[model samples]
Target: MDLDFYKKQALQKQKEHKKFLDGLKKKPPKNLDYQVLETHEETFEEIDCLSCANCCKTTGPLYIEKDIERISKHLRMRQADFEAKFLRVDEDNDKVLQDLPCFFLNDDNTCSIYDVRPKACREYPHTDRKKIYQINNLTIKNTLICPATYVFVEKLRKALEK
Candidate 1:
């Protein structure tokens, strides 16, 4: 999906969808996980993230210690050097990329550190996980950043309504 288009759509839909997601959290359907998994699978089938690495361009993964260590090792750099070069502490005190357009993101929209990327990067959009309600807030945020996630939630909203 296009970034500008998705941003507009997500901005318009967020209020209604947030209310709906809140209801799901309050009384989740038993088939919720299964439904979400199907949506996630189908969304990925049609969504090629390489075409639009908005997540890498606009935001970044939260780097855990393991991520730092693994990435440092992969690059043959000291952990402190890696942190100093690539990361900064965010408002939440979590280690995040130093700036937008993550340093490891190549111009071709490929991640330079995909294999050793952060846990958060690997599980992005987080739509198919069990106890999905637990991440409703995060999913709400993701809709603006990831179009496939927006589609998944919209599909989910329609399915539950029926």
Candidate 2:
């Protein structure tokens, strides 16, 4: 995937997407969640996340207590030690990775701790969750970072229109 091209396209459509998403939030279709999940599934069929790990490369996942414990155990490290080594408190007071390109991201764009990755990482872009309309702002922001998100939103818009 040509990330630069997708990023440019997403940037250009930012305002339009935000507007559309806001409208979606106001009064989502009854089956909006279903459509979002369906769209998400189809979008991923064509776009491999390994080909574009911009989300991992550019953004850090919020590490909740359970995630910290799970990942720390998976790596055979003390939770406090793992936190001290790899995480920091963000402005939102959430524990997030200390650096970009995520400390656990291998050279091939695969997560080193794939099985025990953070909940936020497991739900990156978050387009397929229940109550999809509640997270319009996040979905809009993700369009800029994940090409699959961009495609999903565009496809969702079309699906909603008809």
Candidate 3:
């Protein structure tokens, strides 16, 4: 799919989905079935991620202390040097890169340091996992960054309704 088309679709879906979620919050579902349905719907409609690594290109992952150490060590650099050069702690106290389109992301849209990338980077979409309910907030965030989240939620909602 075209990147621009998917980007537009994702943005439109996000707005609609947010409204749906807001409504659900006002009058929460009585059972897990409803939540599952909503998720399925969102999932089924999402765009493919490989075609557009917008998340990697437009945002940085939160790097924990261990990730920072591991990645820095892999780069043959001191932990402090790595932090000074590439990362900073966000207001939420999570270490994140200072800029988007991550420094580790290569021109081909692949992670240059995939083996030692941050935990959050490794778990980008967080939609393919079995335990969907455990990370609703994370899923919501992924909705903005990943088209896969949109597709995953759409599929989940359909399954629930079935």
- Each candidate's clash count: 0, 0, 23
Q: Each candidate's TM vs. the true structure?
A: 0.95, 0.95, 0.73
The residue ranges of model 1 lying beyond 4 angstroms of the native Cα positions read none
CA lDDT, every prediction? 0.90, 0.90, 0.70
Q: What is the lDDT of residue 60 in candidate 2?
A: 90
Q: What count of clashes does model 2 give?
A: 0
Best by TM-score: 2
Off by over 4 Å in 2: none
Estimate, for each residue in 1-162, the C-alpha lDDT of model 1 and write its tens digit. Answer: 578898889999999889989999999998998988988898889889999889888888899999989999999999999999989999999999888898889999998989998999899879889878888889999999999889888888988898
Error of 2 at 148 (Å): 0.7
Please give the lDDT score for candidate 1.
0.90
Residue 35 of model 1: what lDDT?
A: 88
